[model samples]
Target: MGVGLYLHFPFCQQKCNYCDFNSYAGMEHLLPKYLSAIKQELFLYKVHVSVVNSIYIGGGTPSLLAINDITTLFDSIRRNFYVADRAEVTMEVNPGSCTLEKLKVIKMNGVNRLSIGLQSFNNESLKKLGRIHTVEDFIRTYQYARQAGFDNINVDVIYGLPWQTGEEWQDTLAGVVELDPAHISLYSLTIEEGTPFGRELKAGKIKKIDEDLEAEMYENAVKLLKANGYEHYEISNFAKPGKRCLHNQIYWRNEEYVGIGAGATSYMGRVRYTNVKEIPLYIEKVFGNDYATAEKEALKLDKIIGETIMLNLRLLDGFRMDDLTKRFKTNIDQLYGPTIKVLSNQGLLKEEAGMLKLTDHGLMIANQVFQRFV
Candidate 1:
């Protein structure tokens, strides 16, 4: 398999309340320099990677770039990497940031998939989340993407908001199903320490929904999406048949990929590393030294096995013991048989037809199961 390439654009028009990513707001002044730094960073990886099968342009809203800048970015990628002809090229877009002209330009430059950030269909919820777009803006953007010839599209939604109700959650699912996007990603809200929601939670101004209610919301989403012909391929992702996000599958399968731009991570040659998070520092290091790695770790054999199991179990289909043995050249059962047996007896996991998978109950407390391997 060829290496997957991920490029991060860290600029957003306005940062959302719940975001704690490497993204920043009001960085428009640095756009030109940032793109230049990204191109330079891509060049530094040319000697290391020979073939790239997938290119994911994720961000702080990559659609916020200007027309010419987008074209230039793709041109630089082609210049530096041997991109496959049938590569899955995906770009993350926000509703208010994309226009019909911009979408057309993006398509013409070879982006075949788009992951739109439509966190909620309700205008009130959108406002509460500090989203810049409304229901109308999202609808218009989705329509524009379809008109621009993108058939494989993914819609991102979040459940478990501070004041969300079961009915409202169902309505969001129904609304997205009506749109019939090729894929859907469902995420439960997590209040990280530095985000606005986290502060509100700390101040006791906002409260998390009841744990039971959150689980019910997830269960309802699974049923509703499946009934609409979407496959629950991953724990948090649903897809129409043959439309799964290929780049993410690389990570889940514990394969190698290269990451570019500020705060991006790469797993190559059995070593994992992340780039510097600060934009100015990233630019300086990339231009001055041709690399901007901030931290790295070389994996030991046992560590690799543990991490591989942790990532693969996220797929609903699970991984085979035989496959694990073959990949790592070791006896899988000898290493983890006892833990598996214990988990199975507790009804948190099951093994059937040589495949090991999570039971329905296991999916709810997946973190606990993963902790066993860790």
Candidate 2:
């Protein structure tokens, strides 16, 4: 199988309160130099670039780049790698960062998909989350994307926000249904330890929504999106039929992928590697001037099996008995029999047609079920 490519753009107009991605708040001036560094890095691995089937440009805000910058970057990719003619090319954008003109330019440059971040539509919630766009911004951006000839798009929404009302949650879902994006990613809000939200939480200035309320909101989201014709393929992602994120499915399927840029991770064969988190150091290393890798770890068979189970279990189709056997060189029943039995007995999981899947109850208590694998 061909490896997917992920390029991280660690620059955003403003960092969100809950975000802990290696993205920076400002650094537009460094783009030219950064682009050069990325291209230089691409050149170094040019020989290993022939098997790419998908290229995802994710970010602090990839849409912050001028159309010309994106065009140049795409040109460099073509010059250095062999991308399939129908490769899924996706770019992540914040609603506040794009113009119709820029979007059109993006389409012309071979970007076939756009994942727009519209965390919430309610003005109060947007402010609370520190989003730069209003609901109107997301609406206009959707309109422009349609006009600019983009047929595939994913809109991201977050539930479980602090102080979010149930009514507000329903209203956001209603608004998203009206927009009718091809794909939707509904994520629960989590407070990572180093984020601003985390700090506020530790200081007791902010509160997490009650677990029961969070679950209710998530249930509401699933019902609303399904009624609007979205398929719940993964826990946090839904899509209109046949429009599920292909590149993402590659990860859920436990396939190999290569990551480029600061803090990006790559998993190929048995090797897992990440680039330096600092831009200057990343550039230096890419230019053969230093050896500053942020992290690298080689996996053994047990870790690989655990990781494969962890990732694949997130999908609706669940794990395959045959594939697990082949990959781990162990009988699936013999290795995980006890854990599987316990989960099945608890009605959290079941085996059907030779694949294991979560029951509706299991999906809610998924973390507990997954922990048994470790």
Candidate 3:
């Protein structure tokens, strides 16, 4: 299979309360330099292939770019490498910033998938989360996407926010189902230090609910989405039948992908590379062919297999023994013999239909299971 491509745009209109992603609130002036550096780095990883099967342009909000900038970026991709005609080109949008006119331009520029950031359908929750868009804005954005003829779209929603009730969560899920998006990403709220939520939490102004309540919310998500005909493909992702995120699947399968822009990570062949986090430094390095990649690790084969098994288990279908053997030259039993046996005996993992899969209990306690492999 061909490699996947990931382009990061680290600009947002306004940072949300709960977000700690490597994004900035006001850095629009640096976009040109950033794009030039990104193209330069893309040239560095020139594979022989003319096209990759998937290209996901995620961001602080990629839709924030001007039409000309978007055109130039896609033009660079077309010129620099092979892009399959049916390549899943995704662009992330914030409902407040992405107007209908912008969505039209993005669609015309060959972007086939849209991932809208709509954390909740409640106005109060939106305010608490520091989101700029209201519930009505999300509705309009969804309508505009459908009007623009984008059938493969994803909506990102977060649960377990401050003061969110179980009934409110059900309402959010119901609103999402009414939109009928192809994919939905359900996230549990996490308080990251340095974010607004974190600061408020430390000051005792914003309190985190009980862990049991959060788990209940997660279980509620599964039940609600399943009832709406969305398959729980991965722990946090649900899709309509076959609408899984291909770029993400590549990551889960331990395949190669090229990441552009500040703080993006790439795994190619067996080496893992991360770009410099500082935007100015990123531009400086790329301009001089000294693109200051912060880290590079040559993975050992045994270590690679272990990592692969760990990521692959995140999928509901689990890992294939045959494929695992082919890649690692050692079967799962050889490397993770004790771990697998213990998990199997505990009914957390099992061999079924010639593949290893997670039990219902396993999915809930997946991180614990993965720790054993690591």
Best by lDDT: 1
Alpha-carbon deviation at 344 in model 2, angstroms: 1.7
Sort all candidates by lDDT, best to worst. Answer: 1, 3, 2
Native-referenced Cα lDDT, model 1: 0.93
**Winner by lDDT between candidate 3 and candidate 2:** 3
Each candidate: what lDDT?
0.93, 0.86, 0.87
Model 1 residue 203 lDDT? 99
C-alpha RMSD values across all candidates: 0.9, 1.5, 1.3
TM-scores of the candidates in the order shown: 0.98, 0.96, 0.97
Q: Please list all clashing residue pairs in model 3, or write none if there are none.
A: 50-82, 51-82, 51-83
> How would you encode candidate 2's per-residue C-alpha lDDT over 1-374 as one tens digit per residue?
57798888998888889998899887777788788888877776676657679999998899999878989999988888888887899999888789999999999989999999998889888888888899999999989999999989999999899888888889888998898899999888999899989999999999999999999999988888899899999988999998989899888877888888888888877778888998777777777744335788998767677677867888977877688898667877776777778889999988889888888999898888788876
Pick by TM-score: 2 or 3, better one: 3
| Residue lDDT tens for model 3, 289-351 | 865588888998878888888899888988787888887667767778788889999999988
| lDDT of residue 237 for candidate 2 | 90
Q: How many angstroms is residue 72 displaced in model 1 relative to the true structure, after the best TM-score fit?
A: 1.1
lDDT of 3: 0.87
